[model samples]
Target: MTRIALATASADLEARFRAATGGAFLPLPPAPLPSNPAHLFAQLDGAPAPDVVVLDAELAVDHALDLATLLDEQCPQIAVVLVAEHGPDLGLAAMRAGVRDILHPQAEIAEIQSVLDRAALAAQALAHTVAPASSDAPPATGRVISVLSPKGGVGKTTVATNLAVGLARTAPNSTVLVDLDAQFGDVATALDLAPEFTLADVVHGSAARDSMVLKTFLTLHETGLHVICGPPSPAAADTITSEDVSQLLQMLSLEFRYVVVDTAPGLSEHTLAALDRTTDHVLLTSMDVPGVRGLRKELDTLAELGMLTPARHVVVNFADKRGGLSVADVEATIGTKVDLRLPVSPATRVATNKGVPLLQSGGRDPVTKQLRRLVERLTIPETVTAQPDPDSRPPRHGRRRGR
Candidate 1:
C-alpha cells in the first residue's frame, strides 16, 4: 500500500486530498515544515515512515526546500512534492531541492490523485536503485536480439514484430519485443495494441525492481508475444535515460527466452544501451544506394566500438532485380555476406496498413516466407551461435559473446 503524509494548513485542501486518497492520508501539523527526515518521521507518532511527503510551500518556502533536501539525502525513498504557486523560479528551486513535482494550491482531487500516483512510483524507483544486491551469483539471461538499420523506412520494425511473433509461436509466453525508438516508435500500431503501460512506465517504479511487477506492465498480443511499446509521446522520451534502458533490458533478459529490440534508425544513447546487452544483431538495409552506404558506415562504426556481435545477420530489404541493386553489390559494399533478402511485395504494405504481420496472418506471401526463414535462424539454438571469422579481431571490451 502507498503511504502518504500531508503537511498543509488549509482545511479545504486536506478535504480534497482525503477525497482523492479515500481518506487514507496521515495528516501532520499544518505549519513550520520539519527540519529533517528524522524530525518528520518523529511527527508520524510511531506510524510507518511515509512513502510520499506532501509539503505546503505557501507559508515557509525556504523551510520546505531545506526539508526536501534533507529528505533526499537521509530518506531518499520518500518522494517530496511541494504545493505552491507554480512558477519558473520555484520550479527550478524545487528541482534543485529534490522535489519530485510541484502542484498548484488549488489542484482538484483527480489531479491530486494523479500526482500522488506518480510520486509513489518515483519513490519505488529511488528505493530500488539505491538498494544493494541480495545475492552474489550472476543472473541467468536469455538471448537478446536487436534489429536495427542506419536509415528510416528500412522495414526494421516490420521485421522485428514478425520475428518476435514467430518466436512466440515456437515458445509461447517466453518472448518480449521492446520498441526502443523512444520518440516515434510504432510497434503498438503495427500490433494493433492499446497498451495500458509503456516503456516509460515500466522502466521505473516497482516494475523496474521486481520481475513479477514488470511482467504485469507488458501488453499481451494475440499471437502470445509480450511487448513494451515506446513512450506515449516524443516529450516522454526525454525522461527515460540510457541507464534505465540498460537496466530494463537486463531484467527482461533474465525472464524471457528471447528479448527482441526494435531501435530507431540511428544510434541514439538508448540504442547504444540496448546494443550493450544484445547477443545478436539483425542488421537491415534497403536496396537503394543511400541505404547501402549508410549500412556500410554503421558496420564500420560498430566494429570500431567493438559492439559487432558474433551472431550477426545482415538483411537486405526491398530487394528487386529492377532496382539497379543486387545482393552481390550489397555484399561488395559492406564486405559481408547478405544473410537474408526480403523481396519487395505489395502484400507487405497492406499487412502493415492493416496492423497485422504477414506471419501472424499465416499468409503465403513472399515476404512471409523470408520472415519465417529469419525466425528459424533465431529459434534454432545452433544457428544463434555463429562461428567467428578467423580474420576479425576480438571485441575491444572483452565482452563475452554467448550466455
Candidate 2:
C-alpha cells in the first residue's frame, strides 16, 4: 500500500484527504507539524519516505522557498502536492519551487482522488524503475525517452508522436509510444486511431503486470508502430498510478527497442513519474519568451531535484527562421544547448485537422524530418547503454542509472 504524508495545518483538509483516499491505500500516518518550517525537512530526514507529500500553500508561501527546495532535495522522488485557497501567484510560486501538483481546498473528492492516484503511480514508477539498480544489473534493453515542456502549447504531443512513428519507420519492430498526459492526452488524436481501449483500462483492470496488459490497450498503427494512449476521459486520469506507468514502461523496454513517452506539460506528478521512468528526457519549447523562461525554470528545478540527467535533450519545436528570437538566443537564455530544432509548418494544422500525424500524411515536412533525426539520435545503441561507474557520475545520471 502507498503511504502519504499530509502537512496541512487545517484539520478539515486532512479529514477530507483521509476520507476520500482511505480505501485506496494504507492508513495515512498523523502529520505532526514541526516546531517550525525548518524542522519539517528534519522530520522527513529519517522517516521511511512517504510516497506523496501534500502541503498547504499557506505554509509554503509564508515560509521560505527553502522549505520546498529542501523537500525536493531531501525526497527527490516524492510527489509534492500543494493545496491552496486562491491566488494565481501562489500557484506560480509553488510551481517555480518545484511543487508537483496544485490543488484548491475546495477541489472535489474526485480531484483529490486523482491527485492521490497520480502520486501513487509516480512513486511506484520510480520504485520499479530504480529497483534493478539495487543489484549489479546490466543495461536496459530498450531506449526510454520522455518528451516534456515547462508550459503548454509547445507541440510536445505532435513531436512525441512523430518521433515514435519516425523511430518505427527507421527501425521497425522496436518503437513504442506512450501518452503520460492522462488529463489532456492528444496522442490518439494526432495518430488518428480511435483506440478501443486506453491506459486507464489497463490500470483499472486486473492485469498482473505492464507487459501482460500492454497489448490489450496499445493500438498498432498501419506504419507498424505501437502507441499506449492516455485515459479515455479526464475523470479516469487519476485512476492510473505512477506504478502503473512505470511498470508499463518497464514491460515495454523488454519488448521494444525504443519507448517514447509524451509527458504532460509541466513537472506535475504524472510528468515527474514519466521522467523517472525514462532514461532520457527531451524538453520541448517554442520561441515565446514566457515559454523559454518557463523552460529554464523547469530545467533548474529538475537539476535541483537531480532529475536532469546528462542524457537530457532540449528540442525547440515550431522553430522558424523568421521568428523574433533565433535558436542562439533561446539557447543563451536557457543556458542549455538546443539539440534539435523543428521548423514550423502550416501543414501542422492541416495534419492535426485531418486527425493524422505529419509523418504519416505523406508530407515532406521539415519538422517531420527533424523529429525523426532526434529519435534516431536517441535510439542509438551507444546512447542507450548504461554507464559503467555511476557513483562518480552526476546526480541525474546516478538517479537514471539507479546507482
- Report the number of the highest-lDDT candidate: 1
The TM-score between candidate 2 and the true structure equals 0.60
Instruction: Write down the worst ten-residue block by lDDT for model 2.
Output: 384-393
Runs with alpha carbons beyond 4 Å of true place in candidate 2: 1-140, 208-210, 381-393, 397-403
Candidate 2 structure quality by residue, lDDT tens digits, 241-335: 77777677777888788898899888777677767767777788998789889998887777666776667778887787787989889988888
Top candidate (TM-score): 1
Cα lDDT tens digits, model 1, 1-403, are: 8889998889989999999999999998766777665456546655666789999988889899998997786567779999999876898899999999988899998899999999999989987976656788876789989998999999999999999999999989999999999999999999999987899887866667756456756888999999999988999999999999999999999899999999999888898888999999999999999999999888877876778878989899999989998899998898788888999999889989999998899888888999999999998878765655454556554333342
Off by more than 4 A, model 1:
1-137, 389-392, 397-403
Query: What C-alpha RMSD separates each model from the true structure?
Result: 13.3, 18.9
lDDT of 2 at 148: 88
